[model samples]
Target: MALSEREQQVLRDLESQLHQEDPGLADTMDSRTTGPLRLSPRHIGAGVALVLVGMSLVVGGVVVRNSVISILLGVVGFGMAVWGVTLALTRVEAGGGPGSSRRPSRRSSFMDRQSQRWDRRRGSQG
Candidate 1:
């Protein structure tokens, strides 16, 4: 289901706050993370191609009177076509590429900064 206007507003507000606090955090988020895969056309085409290839193999087997090899080849072709179609629908890279600035996931940058500030205050107090 689609997000309601109010829900969208809330999300935007939260994102705005995040951006205000962290300059480059929004760049880390993938725009397509929430969107649909949109694989309908490719999926349908793959299904139809699979069916056709399998049917052809079956018919060829009947003609040649060799069911085993025909079934195997057809199954392989169908699997490959379906895999290709699935790959086509998927995106290449998720987040921003090499040039894109990324915050260190393991770095406790925020907490470390706050702690440093606290240490400075404690030193000054002493």
Candidate 2:
């Protein structure tokens, strides 16, 4: 069901108040924002290409008659394939790349609070 205009206004007001009171919490709760890890088409394409080239090199190494050259080619091919797979699986950050100036969200703060509680409990028990 669609929200009525009055309900939408109320929600907006509530959201604004939340942001004003606790920006970290608001950010954490906001579903509109993207997460840290995002897939990159460019990276996927490059990784796939590398994997294919690596596989071909391995095949070529197998077909070659020379033992030393075949071994070298095979090793190189394996390395390339591994690198390609790693690249393909890697994801880019959503916001301003790594080491951005953005404040830590409520999630981290919550985790920190939990850790602190755990530590205190441990100290008490010990």
Over all chains combined, what TM-score does candidate 2 have?
A: 0.49
lDDT values for all models: 0.63, 0.85
Candidate 2 residues lying further than 4 Å off, grouped into runs, are 1-34, 96-126
Task: Judge candidate 2 against the unseen true structure and give its global Cα lDDT, from 0 to 1.
Answer: 0.85
Poorest stretch of ten by lDDT in candidate 2: 95-104
Model 1 earns a TM-score of 0.31
Can you give the TM-score per candidate against the true fold? 0.31, 0.49
Estimate, for each residue in 1-126, the C-alpha lDDT of model 2 and write its tens digit.
999999999999999999999998998777445566776777788899999999999999999999999999999999999999999888876543455535456567888999999999999999
Could you give candidate 1's per-residue lDDT for residues 37-122 as a string of tens digits?
44454445666666666566555655664668766766666666566555445443332323434544325577799889999999
Q: Model 2 Cα displacement at 27 (Å)?
A: 15
